[model samples]
Target: MTNRLTKTLLALAVAFAMPAVSFAQDTCSNRGDLDEQYCDDNHDLTADTPTDPKKLKTPNTLVFTFTPVEDPAVYDKIFKPFTDYLSQCTAKKVVFFQVQSNAAEIEAMRSGRLHVGGFSPGPTNFAVNIAGAVPFAVIGDANGYQGYTLNVIVRKDSAIQTMEDLKGKKVAHTAPSSNSGHMAPVALFPALGVTPDKDYKVLFSGKHDQSILGVNSGDYDAAAVASDVFDRMVERGVISADNFRVIWSSEKFPTQDFAYAHDLEPNFRDKMLQCFYDYRFTDELKKAFAGADRFYPINYKKDFEMVRFVARSAGESFNRAAYDKQNAGKK
Candidate 1:
């Protein structure tokens, strides 16, 4: 089997591993969109902390990862300084887990192998609902939380100058669960006179960098990707701004969210959250993440309202059935 097929099979396997029925269905009065193993008693739309002490974890090591928006190795290096600081601050060994796909990352958290990580905006929904992820912070600076835009880009030499020009052309979307890469375009492009699957064939490049690189190499006639990822590539000299033109752009959306597993021991969870809140970004991290310098406080209920709106506008949900359906599409 090809590497792509292997990855798809792995994602499906993880999805199937999630329990179909709640273990504590008798206790949970509300679950919202969260999975069966989780509860949402506060109606915050995220999994609540387990009341059973036996279910709470206090690991000796904390596993951290960032969203797979680009090369995992790139972020592994970029995030090293912070992970080192986190280790000292939390008095625990911190391991930076490199995940190749969103599904793998979510599964790691759900399985209790991951302690804390940054999840991409789109997949944050699934992470919160299915993986018991509790979003608490976002990358930000003195101004506030940072945001990114969905940019439809094409080679400057390419004839596709407008959104409508993309009709019947090969266009790449980063992934099925990506916000800027796929969901935003599906919701916003129709009014602009371009529908993704209807106007052109939608191809999943699996990552924002791949989509941008594919467009650069003419493998794709156009690609919808996050502006921040595109900017980072140009800043790193991976690509030149002059070589590509953004045919269209959308409003700013929240960037990656730093979240922790909800099942962590309450005291340890608070301490870990404090460590994140108190930490500051290194100069290299600031440059790599568009000058963001700190993990700004946030809650999923308020911070993700716009994201939920976009998903709803596109007829998407964060439920397990939706996740399974999306994974099935990968096959």
Candidate 2:
């Protein structure tokens, strides 16, 4: 591991060891992989809304955020139109919370500071299991939900040309909880004749953009990154597709999930969901999201089945223990 990464892991260990905020303990027949504070009474594999009416929230202002896939300032501007529409639609003050990392975003919601936000696929499982985040929508259009592939990228001039060539090289994985960036690659790469930690020491780049940039700058030999993020970088002229070659690519995986805190009042939650489902993306929003034009509805239990499968295949879990271990370096 890099010196920076070693220091980061140490910091994470300390941060994750802190006690979680206390909630009244209630017995549930099946909690599944959720934290002890949450219950999965319906067996949906997500936190259920609080049974006690007093526990439900009807906040005056709604705080929103997007996944920290790239520069927060860029997304704050790109999502301005949608946030405005959400405020008008829900008749509430909406504020965009610029979270620095996946761990911060999840904690904000878990503490009831964040009302709704978009979560990347891998961290979405963590958010659901530990933060009471209920995913309800994804970026898509008439055809179906938008998806992305795992692209193992190397600079066009690099000596690394195949999966086998990655042995003994520095390979970047965005974060421990990232799907395409880490988990999926772990589950799928071995069949390609390379094992992540065994064949090559894995390095955490913290985000897909960073991984792509690292590979381009020779900071790492290659990187496993989400295709959509790579495409977005190319579209914005941040990098040229011609400059990098994808040595390997996996099948398409689901994109980020737009989720809300499970404790929101039912009527208020339904109204807010309607706002998301009804609003059409502006031209700029469409352009930023790779042609996706709307928040396509989804179910966590059904839609995330494949994501869960990959996590399991990779010997990963989204329970509290796993969350604490994996997310420490994310922030």
Candidate 3:
């Protein structure tokens, strides 16, 4: 089978693995949108650790994954140094698990095959609610967490000079769960007089690189993508900035979040967090991640409020049903 078909089939398989769940917790009065397996007795919008010692896990081997926005192999190499540090710091065998899609990453964590991961802004909500992810840090410099923007790009020769000009044109969105590629457009595009699905049909390219390449090859008239990904593409000479015109840009949004599964043994979890916060990135690593030198601390409920708001505005809840719908129709 072609790679595209394989990817679609894999996504569908993972989607089916996400069983139906009810968020109601008899113990917590306000569990918010968390899955039934989790509780938020403290009112924090995150999963609470299992109170029972038998339910907590302290594995000899720790599995790590990064958001599958780009090539997982590329990230596997990029994160090797940190994984080595993690192994030594935590005194365990650390392995990098290269997941092919956001759904697969979330499922790996949910099944305990993954111990910790870096989830993209849009999928972080899904990870938290459905996979018991507890976001604690994001890549940033000393100032704070780094941020990226949503950019709508079209070929310079294309007639689409404004967002309104995109009507009736083929547009590319990375994935339905992507913040810049999909959700942001659904929430913000109508204001610019170009509505997705109504004004034009969205083409799912699966990844930002695919969307960028699609627009460059004339497969798409325009694409909504993350600025950081666009910048990296330009830096890597995969595409030229002068060849593309950015018609619209949104306010800065926080970059991907690094979170751990909430069911880890408390002492092990604390040591792992410290290991992440203490390490400094190499120069190459910093350059690869837009100058982010360290994993700066953050609170998910506060740092991700804007992302959650955008999801809500688009009539989305990061629950199992949403995940299933997002993956079931993958193109």
**Which residue runs of candidate 3 sit more than 4 Å off their true CA positions?**
1-26, 329-331
TM-score for each candidate, following the candidate numbering: 0.91, 0.91, 0.90
lDDT of 1 at 4: 94
RMSD of each: 9.7, 10.7, 10.6
List the pairs of residues colliding in candidate 1: none
Worst 10 residues of 3 by lDDT: 18-27
Residue 314's C-alpha lDDT in candidate 3?
Answer: 80
- What would the per-residue lDDT of candidate 2 be over residues 1-331, giving only the tens digit for each residue? 6999999999998677654322224558789999988889999998999999999999999999999999988899999989999999999999999998999999999999999999999999999988999999999998999999999999999988899999999999998898888999899999999999999999999999999999999999999999999998988899999989999988888898899999999999999999999999999888888999999999899999999999999999999998888656534
Best by lDDT: 2
Q: Residue 246, candidate 3: how far off, in angstroms?
A: 1.1
- Model 3 quality (TM-score): 0.90
lDDT of 3: 0.90
lDDT of 3 by residue, 1-331 (tens): 6999999999998787655323222456656788878888887799999998999999999999899887888889988998998999999999999999988999899999999999989999999999999999998989999999999999989988999999999999998888888999999999999999999999999988899889999999999999988887776677899989999999999998999999999999999999999999987678778878999999999999999889888878897777778778553
